[model samples]
Target: MRLAEIPLCVWRTRGQTFLFRGQNIRYWTAGQGEPLLLIHGFPTASWDWHYLWQPLAQRYCLIACDMLGFGDSAKPVKHHYSIVEQADLQQALLAHLQVRQPVHVLAHDYGDSVAQELLARHHEARAAIASCVFLNGGLFPERHRPVLIQKLLLSPLGWLVGRSFTRDDLVKHITQIYGPQTRPSESVLDDCWSLIDANHGTRIIHKLVGYLPERIAQRGRWVGAMQHGDVSLRFINGAFDPVSGHHMLERYLELIPNPDTVSLHGIGHYPHTEAPGQVLRHYLAFRQQLQPFKKIACS
Candidate 1:
């Protein structure tokens, strides 16, 4: 299966439909039991969880979504997919999905950042997030991407990424993303390009790159989530991640309290997809470890 299932983005949810703040975004979900919401990062959508759905589905109600702009969700030009806005959208989406209890988030890349925003709003989220598995998108921007592309997208240089989508650039980046476990296939590159191309994917290059707005907005919330003791956090660090280098895990620990950090030897950024079997085995074992939170004395 693909890292994430892309076709879901194209299909709208049947029962759940609500306006988030204002933007109408669509998410795909399946299964039953406690709600498990999976959010994908940039350049990819809910497809990231394609391989994870089955194993996870057996345990909890699984809901994976294409965040507003990136996935096949509604893509309105100028829509600020910023953190605050996405937080509002996420609440509305959950409400529409009839999600009442706290949800466990399997977040990566921008998705993890979104989870950070959610934790800030609903303090209960800290306790309810059965676990958040990080796959190297650099949630802690200090050690993550932080600047560069964000500056470009926000500034004049933005036009460069916005207007350009060369076959080589797409291949190089996609290929590089899977350097550790296995090489990214051409189909994956095609799907990514399709997502970018599905809608003037190239034009939004700058706008999508501009996702820093969401990260910047969540900076404070990340700190808040760290201080708050409700959430259970763990890191599946990709040993070979260059961009994140050695900083992501440390920063993750800073905010996540006594986080359980695991090392995926020789893996790059996309651990879930790169070493699905390996990740799955470890994740299952991690889930079995028992831990209780006193902070979340049930109301």
Candidate 2:
């Protein structure tokens, strides 16, 4: 069934904020069951989950936040942004909420990297993540194919590029990542640009793009966590995504033992947005196969 869409304004209204390390982080939560955490990709926020929010919330308590520099959250121009810090933010949020049960993580793009770090913690018995499902992302640095804009953002001229970047430029770059047949609507693109433009977020694009290099430098830790972690794992990919599509899936199957995967033939980077129904169906099927967790006790 096609899920009803959650409008951006309503999404904003439903959200609440809490301070994290002197920055305001916006978050949204609903439903009640096993805890499920949703982490979005770079340049986007928790609103990325709006399409699947209600449908997934039907079966799991949902938690999603605009990480320190993205969405409606604070964007500190001088602060350093790293996947490790983002993972810590997620842990802090879970702790702040007093979530005692192991969480089921659904992460996309940049979020996939953050999930990898969290999974690394789980592998070391430092965190309680029950499972992780990755959408399109740079899971393996070698397999990731960043677009031209991303390359530019990483160059020495990156700060200047971020300063001069325009909404049209963002829309153009985002369009390149989706399947031709499933490209986002103008309105959808507008909402995405709105979130990025919030709190002068565009000014910090260069810093946030650091996750690309960070992924490469810490490849062993993150990738090893995926290969060795005992938690349930699944990869749901959109085949046409230029950045991390079929090729990345090939690498995943090569490295991850007993891999569980689902490939959306004509979809692209934003599977949850481009084809929410299929994503929902596949994700639900995967969750159904997992053993049930004990009810989470309230604080």
Candidate 3:
């Protein structure tokens, strides 16, 4: 979709706002079936799911939201953004929607960490995440290769980097993460920049980037969830993603037993955006295989 049409798409979704911890969070819901929660990556919003929204909604009740400091959500300047807090917001959204059914999670980048935390809660009989499908992300902090800009954003000079980073820089850095063959168009890149720049989001980016260190510190708890959690898990990776592509997949295979994975050759960090058809296909296939097990669990 072109940048010109992004607003139309957002309008069609008819996103609404919910009060979360005294902040208004932007969210969208559609269709009516088993609940499917979508968590987007860093520096982006729920709109990241725009590519697969309708298709996925056709099969499941879709729930997506912009966490604090992202997308159309409240961006409190001093609020500390952490994966655990984001997990709390996800749970709050489910409860607000009165979603009693076990939910399937589709997450990417920063969202992956939030999903991991949710999975950990599920292990503790706290959340009802039935399954999870991870896109490219720093699942293992050790294997995560942050780009130069990310490193800068996480450094002591991060505040300066956030203030000085421009749209061109965003396009440049984002382009580097995409596969060589499947780079995003200027319009898409523009939309990304606009989303990031909206409501002074760039200002709090340094604070949000805190997730990197938090990921490392809490790696044991989150990875333990994936390693031992009862919920079904799948990793659908874009093989060409520089940040967490093939190498990340290798780590997943090494650590996760009986792993279910799909590697899209030449695809990049944003698989759903870069190749929505392939992502939808694999995701649906994974869900289809879970039907029998889902029924048993629900019973």
Candidate 4:
């Protein structure tokens, strides 16, 4: 059976969906304690967290969701995909779930941008974010490396590229980003292809790629939050990732005040997926360092 069809040993069988902005948003909740929200990257959904889910759930009330246009969620072809909108959907999801206490955010790839926006809101006292752990991501737009395909899809000729995008193309591009030592298995590729194919999501790559430009425009606000020192921010990186690995870390050290980073020497872009155990250990340790905040009950 394909990994796409078979749940990981750690995956929970049950899932729930909520109506958000007239669309169905799929999510899963498990465990109990302080709420920890897992935000996944572009072209993937909450499934990216499966390896860490069952274990982390034992310690926190884990909530992972498929943001609009990804995974099993509604994929609207014409909708404008913005990091701020994604962040708003996340806030709305927490409100709908009635989780009033501040949440610990663990975000990767595109989700990291969403997390940055959330952290910015927290800085402005507009949201409840306790702590954040960012996996390999393009937090610094200046350090971002958009793969040729991403650049093509975001270009004026994006419609042609989107139309030509195929499962083989997806598998090839994704596999290239992993470390030489931790190449993704066929099953992993299958799962990704299945998710992207669901709801004809591949067709919306042009719309989804819009976040790249938005990231550039809002860099001052989002990156400012990371540098502001309002809430604790730690980055756990996979050093081998050609995209946002060591280069981005260098920028983080030069920019953010007192930045914290754990380098996984041989790992790549998807540390949580490529090396979950190590990522989890460093993540748990990072969480421990943040000064705990008293939980606020949502009336």
* lDDT of model number 2: 0.90
Which tens-of-lDDT digit does each residue in 4-105 have in candidate 1?
A: 442433333432444555655656667888787877877677776667767787887888666667656666776544655665666667778777787777
**lDDT of each candidate versus the true structure:** 0.64, 0.90, 0.86, 0.85
lDDT of 2 by residue, 83-199 (tens): 999999999999989999999999999999999999999988888998999999999999999988899999999999988888899888999999889888889888988999999
Measured against the true structure, the TM-scores of the candidates, in listed sequence, are 0.83, 0.96, 0.93, 0.93
Candidate 1 regions exceeding 4 Å error are: 1-24, 124-131, 146-151, 213-217, 254-256, 290-299
lDDT of 1: 0.64
Candidate 4 per-residue C-alpha lDDT over 85-147 given as tens digits, one digit per residue, 9 for 90 to 100 = 999999989999999999999999999999999999998999989899999999999998878
Best by TM-score: 2
The candidate, 2 or 4, that scores higher on lDDT is 2
Query: What TM-score would candidate 4 get against the native?
Result: 0.93
Clashes of each: 12, 0, 0, 0
Scored by lDDT, model 3 comes in at 0.86
165-269: candidate 3 lDDT, tens digit per residue? 899888878899998888988887777787788789889888898999999999999999998936788888898998999999889888886778888888889
Rank by TM-score, highest first.
Answer: 2, 3, 4, 1
* Candidate 1, poorest ten consecutive residues by summed lDDT: 290-299
Task: Give the better candidate number (1 or 2) by TM-score.
Answer: 2
User: Total clashes, candidate 3?
Assistant: 0
| Candidate 3 deviant stretches above 4 angstroms | 1-13, 291-299
Report how far residue 97 has shifted in candidate 2, in Å: 0.6
Best by lDDT: 2
Which stretches in model 4 have alpha-carbon errors above 4 Å? Answer: 1-13, 291-299
**Candidate 3 similarity to native, TM-score:** 0.93
